[model samples]
Target: MDQETLPPNKRELLKQISSPHNPKEESLGSSSHKPSPKPFWSPLSLQMSIQEYELLKEDDEQCLRKYRKQCMREMHERLSFGPRFNGVHELDSGEAFLEVIEKEHRLTVVVVHIYKAGVKGCEVLDRCLDCLAAQYPSVKFCRINAAVSGAGEHFSDNVLPAVLVYKAGEMLGNFLAITQHFSDEFLATDVEAFLTEYGLLPEKDFRAAGDEADVE
Candidate 1:
């Protein structure tokens, strides 16, 4: 009985059975269900061999010796201002790093140091670093290698190439600076907020970012 198909109801049933609702069908679901890329500032271990470690240790000693030889009074600097992130510390099992949580909260600043392979870390590096040294020095500033780790977990690749401040073992929670680009006022606000939280500064009227830009 081929009268332009057996009947309307029968034809519709055949179509429904042959073309079932397919998950693979387009526009049937949310586009944003895909996972986000990890933060770019994820912790990474700086790779080095035993000999390299020895060399660094020896070199640091030599620098101290030179400082001693050159001056009658020892002039000091914050050479290792923040937690040493040679990868060993940042990637340690959760238990081992718990000590940091208890340690008095100092500003733990992580600078997502980015440099093209074969590039030198010099003046230009300092230019970008103004937000750190001038704006957020009260925090202990450390650095991490960004190019090596770009996975998009909040602390990994998603913000790749980001500068983050952590305090009391929580990322972003105790932070003042979380990005590479910031205006002076924005930086000042966060720093002031952090300093207040730590009771390092008074309750009001602090100097702001680039206050010295005009002088220099």
Candidate 2:
């Protein structure tokens, strides 16, 4: 077909078909080098991502706080040098009672229960002291029978359940006939409350409390 004799549209089409195929001149849409469309971020999707990040961060902070508390508790236990006793000691003689009061740590609070067997409240008081001893390790709890205390005449049956609080070998409290302060049937907590009222008991040891909580 002669170019001059063909229709204008046909001549144009023929020109396009005969043109050299230059890769660089390809249509913009067909080019593979076009920068990828900027990633579309929807408002709702962005908000959800932010919320997730905040939740994760909060959890991390809580974990860190618990870890720090545990570390502090452990450090406190390691650094403490105070004497710890878990149960009441039964003194065989008055000299043994004196030794405990004088030889224990200066910071120790010594609670001596001068009790006599078969007394109305002596047995109950002894049981209460046992419970307190387990709770307050820093406090030295001891029991001595009135007959063996070398002062049986002074601590008669009327004062058979006397309690003597000592610190550094000095008596801080002298409660004779201590059973008068409690009901006939009492618990360890009642005894603790009574002593606390007079400021006779020391503050609860933090390390011991933490250990108990862990156990629970």
Candidate 3:
């Protein structure tokens, strides 16, 4: 019988055996796989010269200095309130209140009222401050207990209900005995007007988007 008349499997085996074998193909399919070529090495990659090392060291120092300066700028931005102040916050201790005046006052206008307990004048001002705090979120309003605020005896007698204003860590205005200016029956508007006269409280924000930056 002719090879073409043989079964398909036998025909294929005979054809492969009669064909010339390829050594390159056999090696490609061998048991062990070939490893990749090694990369060329440059002297600069292996070891640095003394001058190069010094230059690298200088570059590292300069980079470190820039990083430190960036961190400090971020810290200043966080403290400076590039944004304005929020609502009122009560200080837990005298130290905390002083810290705010020393560190945080630089950011925005700080209004601190030293109040004594059981004083009708202080209570009236406190209510006024609550109203203003809601209206003017940009100004910081705080109240401290005169007795517990480490203020000397002088504050207890004379400066009860005193409103101290600060901007940029400097005392701008000190209004003592606010009751002398207005009676306890005064409303929030009265207190606002008084503070506005001293440039403590800004005008009411009537812009459409109150939180947006005002365009020039």
Candidate 4:
């Protein structure tokens, strides 16, 4: 190989083969060619993301609940088919009372008040029923004198100011001497609450009651 490095190409190959290998240089070269790793999410950032997701989920659930309630209210309004009566009616004869109870709409709740003219709480109950009838237009409120009911013997003066609730031709409740449940003086609200407690009245429709009041 001493012929002035016999040939130019051969001399160059011999020189590369004679050079020393460096592990550090090889490692540096390999590292420089590698692709960088993606950064990891911090713990705080991960927790915050979870909290944000939970809040959004809760918001969606709340919206869904509100939507369902709105739909139910609309359906209820559309399905209500009962007749509305704004004031208490008076029955002069037992036959008329029977007709009202048997011939009214099946869904209608009929409340009858039995009283004698001079009974202690008869007038007060009458006034309360008038107010209740106005508030609950879906219910039919009626009043009949004990003597006029043709059952005067059964409904004596002692059991005056009685209340009878009927629906679909079935008696749901019968309360004799109903005034004994209230104080000497009571408001329409008292009667309404009492009836509601006994499950005798339906949910109050404030919207309809308000509209009726506006008309008057």
- The models' CA-based lDDT, in order, is 0.42, 0.85, 0.75, 0.86
Q: Which has the better lDDT: candidate 3, or candidate 4? A: 4
10 residues in a row with least lDDT, candidate 3: 207-216
lDDT tens digits by residue: candidate 2, 112-203: 99988789998888889998888788899999988888898999888769999998889999999988888899888998999999998977
Error of 3 at 163 (Å): 0.5
- Alpha-carbon TM-score of each model against the true structure: 0.26, 0.65, 0.55, 0.62
lDDT score, candidate 4: 0.86
For model 3, residues 88-180, the per-residue Cα lDDT tens digits are: 777767897788788873556788988888866888888889888877666788888887677657586556789998877899889988878
In candidate 4, the residue pairs with backbone N, CA or C atoms under 3 Å apart (3 or more residues apart, or in different chains) clash, namely: none
TM-score of 4: 0.62
Candidate 3 accuracy as TM-score:
0.55
Give the Cα error of residue 103 in candidate 4, in Å: 0.8
Return the lDDT, model 1, position 182: 41
Q: After superposing candidate 2 on the true structure, give the runs of residues whose Cα lies further than 4 Å from its correct spot.
A: 1-70, 74-81
**lDDT over C-alpha atoms for residue 108 of model 2:** 83
